[model samples]
Target chain A: MKHFSLRKLFLGCGALALFILAWKLVTDAKLVSPIFFPGPERTYAALVKGLSGGAMLSQTLETVQRMLLGWLLASFVGVFLGVLIGVSRRARAFIAPTLELLRPLPASAMIPIAIAFLGFSDNMVLVVIAFGALWPMLLATIHGFAAMEPRLYEVSALLGLSRAQVIWKLALPSAMPMILASLRLGLTISLILAVVGEMLASRQGLGQSILAASRSFRSPDLFAGIVILGAIGLVGSRLLSFAERRLLRWQAVSR
Target chain B: MVVTQLSTRPRHGEGNSTPASGEARIRIFDVTLSYGSLQIIGGISLDIAPGETICVIGPSGCGKTTLLRMLAGLARPTSGSVELDGSVLGGPNRSVAIVFQDYGKALLPWRTAAGNVSLALEARGCPGAERLAITREMLEKIGLGRHADKYPAEMSGGMQQRLQIARCLAQEPKVLLMDEPFGALDAMTRQALQDEVLGLVATTGATMVFVTHDLEEAIYLGDRIICLQPNPGRVGRIVDVRLARPRNQLLTRENPEFLRLRRELYDLIKDDHQ
Candidate 1:
């Protein structure tokens, strides 16, 4: 099994190397115009320069800041609403339909309306990211609270736990795994929406950098921007999973 | 080995400093529980004395669990009252705790053994500084002190059940109600836990209502056994277990009176099934 993982990693790296070689071969053969598809060497140089000693570093930071702020806002609102809907059947019945109606509408599609309301601003980008990221956490929390074992409630009553005690001690802990899972999903959505908002709203992030470079026919700069975005996503997701593993370590104990 | 453990455990005067506070007399009067038009516990009544162990035995669909739930104040009787020490039971009384059948579901899977036990103390508003000592003390009492840091999923079935019982005991409850708590365990673990429960009851002198399907278990553990008939359950017969105190599992099983009582209970239960 250990060798299998090593072999898997080896295979993954091999595939990436193969793809890069193929792209270089296509450029060498003049299969596409250099103006359209930049050579791998030029793309790599652009990536190194932008990250090490250029404006791309600041662009990456701006994107990350917006994403994190939006995710934090989404998390607070999602958990508050989720707990409210989870603990009360009346609140769920009253609020669930509207949420369901709004849930299916794509966040990207709302960019026009968002721009109309709060045009070309950082708040607009943050709001778009927050709105896009809230659903997963909200829905996950409600499901988590609903799916709790019935017997635990009986134990709670037998212990004479008050309403507040039940919520703080039982409800929150039981719902934590799902909440964390949804929060991870929310973080990913926050990143995606942040980039989209930056591109559409003409803000100073990786998304705007890529779009402007593409329009100006700077293909190397465009590819560099995309690579940085991928690296950011990889790092963000790994961090969230690390926290998830720590929080839910017990679930893995006997199983 | 379990029998020796049972016989050698702490006696009433050994562990408890205040015996009277941990004992409660349960008065049940014509309590009938219904779900819409369906009756469950059909007008049953009984009196359980302090420190006396009463085992309830009945066939499936006999409202055995419902009766236990009503006593624990987890369910309300549709038309009657259950009282503890002459006070009418309203909601869950702070002085009562229930040990449920499915230990896995009853426990908080995330909390460690000590944390689960501490849940009861926390519910009762036990001071933060005092919780650690009481949690450790309760776990040691239930023979789970070594596994204090282990989660419920990490423990065996018997250990999980013991943890559940420990959690209940941490409440310092006056009346202990168990609803087939050992039904999921192997016979050996069941016997060991039964003896453990017997020892705790002896030490605290708490009134106990143990619900089980096993006749020998009822005879071994109870001062009296209430056998209920099926289809809207009510008492069929109440048999007195005149066995001596600190009863040996092996010796008590061999006793002619035990055999005779077991025979009588078998016949009574068989009649109800018919």
Candidate 2:
């Protein structure tokens, strides 16, 4: 397993190296000007400078704060409501169509409405992130709860579990792996909405900084901001996957 | 096969009799169980004497398991009522423990062998110290002390079944209900566990209601074998094995009476639609 993982790591590094090589070639060939796509060294220097004495750190922190709050809110509400809807057939029938109508409206589309309603506050950004993140988490939760094996339910019944105990102990734990999967997916959505909300509805955050830098033709600064967002996203996803691994260790032991 | 009126006959009117000491543990009176439009077991009744080991055997879907579930209070009778002690059973009775067919699923995967056994005691409000003590004792009795810390998934099929049995016995119920507990194991494991089960029953002296599909097993373990036929299942015959106590597999299989009972049971259930 260590050998396999090392080989995979090397392969991923090689792929990144190849992409960078291509990017360098395009710049060297003047296929696009430095103004449009800055070189890696220039972007790195700008990232360092921004971190040292600029607003980049605060912007990144702001983005992270908004993202965390939105994602956490979405996850809690999504799971609670999803379990409720999933367990009761009548509630599912009544609520499903309304949720369906709301889900497909893009997170980006919500920006205009958020701006109209909240006028460029952090509230607008939060609304965008939460609305966008909730759908995947909710869907995953519903699927997880719905897919519980019937035998487990029978065991719960035979053991004389109350409805609440059944949900808390059996249903929740059994649905955990799937729920974690959705949370990871939802986190990515939160990142996208976080940036978009900042870009369209708010005047501060990584997204706003990137937009501001681009307008002033500070290509390296814009790239640095984008890189920070990418790093946050990559780290967030890894964290969730790590959590999934720990929580579902029963599966590992079985294997 | 639906012996409606036959089961209604009052065999023992003492309500509760141990029959051994002339006391009663449980009495079933004209109990009929149904689901939706289907009547599964109609007007069926039996008395489980204290410390008796009774096995129910029939073809598939003969409601053998349903009867066991009804006794366990996992299922309610549609018409007549089942009684435990002298009182009518409504829901799960306090003094009954059930071991199901699927040991893999029956034992909670999250809990270790000892933890699973401890649940029964925990439900009965046993203190933590007593629970731990009883769990260790029961696991040792089932030859599973070494695997007490292991989760159900870590054990083999036979070991898991034993763990479930230990769990049921840990509850120390007066009446024990087992629903084909070894049905899913390999033949060798099944036979071995059968011996172990008989040994446990002999030691504990709890009234046991075991459900099985195999006739030889029924004869090997049961003091009385109740046979049922399908369609809407009901008791076809109640053959008293009358085998001597302290039954061992070799001795029981070697007996002519056991062989005859197996043959008779096979012949009776041959046409069952299940």
TM-score of each: 0.93, 0.89
Clashing pairs in 1: none
Q: What is the interface RMSD of candidate 2, in Å?
A: 2.7
| Model 1 C-alpha lDDT per residue in residues A40-67, reported as the tens digit of each score | 9989999999989999999999999999
Clashing pairs in 2: B16-B24, B17-B23, B17-B24, B18-B22, B18-B23, B18-B24
Give the per-residue lDDT of model 1 (tens digit) for B1-274. 0011111211111111121334348878778776775666677777778888999998888878989988888899987789999899987886888998988899998899999999999998999879999999999999999999999989999999999999988989999999999998999999999999999999988889999999999999999888886556777777888999898889989999999999999998898777
Which residue segments of model 1 deviate by more than 4 Å?
A1-8, B1-24
In model 1 chain B, where is the ten-residue run with the lowest total lDDT?
B1-10
List the RMSD of every prediction in angstroms.
7.5, 3.9
Q: What is the TM-score, restricted to chain A, for candidate 1? A: 0.92
Each model's lDDT: 0.87, 0.81
Q: Please, what are the lDDT tens digits per residue for candidate 2 over residues B26-47?
A: 7777777766656677666677
Where does candidate 2 stray beyond 4 Å? A112-117, B1-23, B121-133, B271-274
- Give residue A109's lDDT in candidate 1 (0 to 100): 92
